[model samples]
Structures are given as structure tokens and as C-alpha cells.
Target: MSYGDHGRPVFSSDPFGTVPPGGGFFTPGPPPGYPPQPPPQSGSVNLFATLSVIFAFICAPAGAVLGHLALSRIKRTGERGRTRALVGITVSYLIIVLAVVALLVWLLRPTHTSASVGSSGRSPTSSSTPVDAALLDGTELTRVLNQPFETNAGSSQRGGVYGLREFGTSDERTEKCVGVLHPAASVTYRDSSMRTFAYQQWSRPTGDYAGAVISVDEAVVAFANPEDAQKLLARATEEWKQCNSQRVLASWGTDGKFDSWTIRDVDTTDSIVTATVGYTDAGSGTIRMPTSRALALKGNNVVDVGVVMFRDPTKSADPETSGIDVARAILDKIA
Candidate 1:
């Protein structure tokens, strides 16, 4: 009767303790039992699904390992995402292996070609002929001046031809020097004094003059003033005379004019010597003049010598301009 005060079932008629048919704890039909099937085993989150997510983000070994673990769990537990995990692991492993092999190949290749060898086994130069020393000697020079003249073989223009008398060559040597000797030509003109004058002009420098000495093969010639030019020309002439006194490779005033001369025994094969001459027109008078001479020398496989002269028409007698005059004088002496 007094259920609240004594230990007794709330409902006397009911055998087991239960909420009254419509009590707050009571719900529809037997607390919604799991459809009369074995009580649903606690469902697990798919490990393979988790692995697939991790593999997609991390990639490579870490992703690969996690994917493998997930696959095993999927096989054991029959997980729903086994296929996804397997794909991720396979892709990540393939990418890593390919990258490593590419890196190794790039690190090892050679960079330049070795020089070619000849059949003889010796250095190519050893088999080449030696340069002749006499080719460099004055004996091979062209007889453009009062001395024997030799052009620079190395400096001469390519495909140039020369006569034996113009240059000398030995079994070991070859003289390939050449030059042109243009004689003076007379030009008739009137001077400021209204007097008819005849001017003679040589096309090239005739003597040792001051200017640059370019390489034939690689010879160099230094020029000086009248005093020095005269001396050098004299020495050159003497050298020529020694070779042949009767023939006198160089001589003065032999070409039918007081200032005219001839160069003998010139080696047309050698490079010619070239020089520039500078001169001023004096008193506005027509005068006979020689052109600047250019000479080139080649020997010992070296061609290096050239001369240029600049003539100042404004300054007739200045020593500064006299350098060209001096050069012309030297040319005259040698001629």
C-alpha cells in the first residue's frame, strides 16, 4: 500500500521492475532493440578510409606505409576502402623510385673532346718541315733598294708568286716575300711664281722611314730620321753589294733620272716593305717627288714589318714633317 516508504515493487501486479507503460523512461516497443538481429557489434570507423586520406596528403614512404597498414586491416576486417588505400600506396612508391633513378644518371657525364691524333703516333708538328733560316737573311730580299731585299713570307698576301732570283729557299726554308716598286712619274704644273715646274712622284716609300712595322710573319722594322735613315740604307746597300758587286742589287740614279733608282734582286715572293711619307708643298711649286715605300719582311715563320709616312702639305720644312722627307731620302739612297 505504501510503496514509497517500504521496499516493494512499484506495481504489485508486475513481476519484473519496469517503468509504468506510459512513464517518461519508457519508449516505443522494448527500447528499440536492433531489429531482433544479433545485437549490432560496435561498428568500427574504416581504417582503410583513414589511410586513404592520409596517403593522399602525405605521399611517399609515410603515405605508402600507412596505406599498407590500412590494406591489411581492410583484409582482416573487411573494410570498405581497401581499393583506395592500395591505389595511393602504389602511386606514391612509383613516384619516389623514378625520382631517385633520374638524379643518379644526371650526376655522371664527360665534357670535352680530346685532340685528334695522327696515324704516325708522333705530335703532328714533329713531322712538319722546319722553317729555313736563310729565308730570313737579307740574301733573299728583293733588290728594290741598293741592297738585297726579302719580303716577309708570313706577311705576304696569300697566293703570291715569286721568282727564284727574287728569294732564296733551302730544303728546310721557304722565302715567300714580295713587294712593288713603282717608279716616279712626272707631272707638269705651274707654281705660284707662274713658272712651269715638273713634279716627280714615286708611288711607294723608297727608304727606311718612321712609322709602324707590321708583322710579315712577325718581323719588325724601326725607322729613324734622315741621319739614321741614311745610315740604315747605306748598310743595307753595302750588304747587297757584298752579295754581288757587278749586279749591285741596289743603285742610285740608274733609271734615267737624277733622283731615279732601281732595286735589283727583289724577291717578288716575299711580302714588300711599306712606308708612309709626309711632306708639305713648298712655295706652291711643282716638284719631283718619290712616293712612300712599303716593305715587308718574313723569316723564321715570322712576318712583321711595315712602314708608313705622312706628308703635311701645310708644313714644308718642319723636322716633324721632315720624318717623311727623311724616309724619302733614305729611299733615294738605297735606290
Candidate 2:
């Protein structure tokens, strides 16, 4: 090497000066006996191991799968991130175990009867007193109907505290007819002091009932005083008497269809009113078997019950007796 004008050393030949025998300007090379060093191994992380950690919080099953794959790949390929794979696996399994335990607890829980719950599986509002709990659940209604019964879809209203407007209508006859069909439609439901209103429709063989033979309905309305309950009973009884032997077309009422009902008879007493109704649809002919209905007053609650028979009533499940029996059972509960 020699110094340039700027006082910097300039290379005249290879600096190490260990040249080859070819006599060209020689360049240094690896030592004669040593093998060439292989390219440095890249230290990239295992892909599965990284995925395991990321999926641990999003999807437990995916995390567990990815963790097992990561362990296998790490062992075969000697990649990094074994600790991350183990952590993901442990957390995923813990979450899975906890979920299984929660499901088991819910499935094995006991059924409650004393406390009334709506079809939605929620209790009534806080304003509901024990008296408002008179509405029967699936278990009670099943026994009353003498068959397995289930709640009708969207036909449950529990823990309601409404004013008389709930029963108001421009047509007097229509209102009276509705009151006869359902005691909750009476003028007493319009009372300012009206309390909780519980109503639910129940049916047997609740699956594929398009060709059903019979159906049952039950309702209960609670008032603050027994006088109000009695007044409701009286109004319903009078309405039934007026609607007797009359055919009323269902427009916007509960039926919500173009069906007509012919009230055959109305039986009224001091506290109970029973009726027999013949039903027909605009397209379907009149159903031979009549529908039996009864309303009973017990303390501050009025119980309404109905049974419609599309076919002949069986001796074991007579429509005429089922409504009366159900009404008695509900009234006994209230008393």
C-alpha cells in the first residue's frame, strides 16, 4: 500500500497479500483447509405458533387446533415460539371447560312452579303482586287440559298494568262480544285501579296443528278490589246474554281472521257465566262440535276459560266439562 495526495492509504494489491499462484493481482480467500460457511440460518418464527396465540381470544377451538399444529411443526422444523403455543392451548382448554360447565348448570336446573313466568321465560314487572301471579303456566294448564299443552306463540302477556283504554272500542256490540269471549275485555278492565293482567293461550300437540281437533284458551285479570271483579263478571254475563243466538264476524279481534261465531246458549249465575258457541270460517264450513266457554269470579281476580272442539268431544275430554273444570282450578288458586 502507498499514500495518495490526500494522505489516505491507497491499495496497491490485496491487503492480506496471501495471493494465489496464478500471478494476477491476488485477492484473499478462505483458509486452504476450511469449508465455506453456509449462509446464516434465518431465525423466522413458526407460522402456526403465531396463529395459535392470535386465535386464542377469537376462537377457542381454532386456537387449540393451531396450538397442536404449532407444537408438531416446531419440533420437526426447530422454529421459535413454543412458549406461545403452550400458552394458547392452555387458555383455550380452560375456556372450553368453563363453557361446558355453564351449559350443564343450565340444563340441570330445577323447574319452578310457585313463581309465575311468561312464555318468554321472564318474570312479570316489579309492580306485579302475588295476586297477579294467578295465571297458570304450562304445567298447570297441561293438567287442566288433560293433555300435554304448550303456550301459543306470541299469545302471552304477563305483568301488565294498563288502563280502561285496553278494552275501549267505537262499536258497542263488538266490545260487548269481545267482553263475552274474554272477561278482560269488560268495562272493569277500564277501571283506573286495574292491576296486573295475565293472559295466555295454550294448545295440545302444539306441533303441526293445522288439522287439529280441539284447542283451549285461559285468561285471568286481577283487580284491586273484589267489587271490581264482580262487576266485570256481571258485565261479561250481560254481554253473553245479549250476544246469545247472534253470529258475530271477527274483524280485528283476537281471531284476526274472517271467521263467524254463533252463540248458541249463555248460562249465567252469581259468579260464573258459561256459553256454547258454534264457529265457522268464510271458506271452511261450520264445525259440528260447539265451543264451550266459562268465566268465574274469585276474590279480586276473574278467570276466563274456553275449549273449542273441531271434532266430537271424547268422553275423557269433553269440551262442555273441560272449560268448567279449568275455571274451577284457576278460581281455587285465586281463593
| RMSD to truth, every model | 24.2, 17.9
Q: Candidate 1 — worst ten consecutive residues by lDDT sum? A: 183-192
* lDDT tens digits, residue span 294-319, model 1: 33211111112222223334422232
Q: How well does each candidate superpose onto the true structure, as a TM-score?
A: 0.21, 0.51
Q: How accurate is candidate 2 locally (lDDT)?
A: 0.65
lDDT per residue for candidate 2 within 68-143, as digits (tens), equals 9998888776778789899989988888888899988866643223233333455322223354466667688667
True lDDT of residue 193, candidate 1: 15
**Candidate 1, which segments miss by more than 4 Å at Cα?**
1-58, 109-335
Q: Which sections of candidate 2 miss by over 4 Å?
A: 1-132, 159-174, 186-188, 191-193, 207-213, 252-257, 281-285, 313-316
Clashes of each: 73, 1
Q: What TM-score does candidate 1 get on C-alpha atoms?
A: 0.21
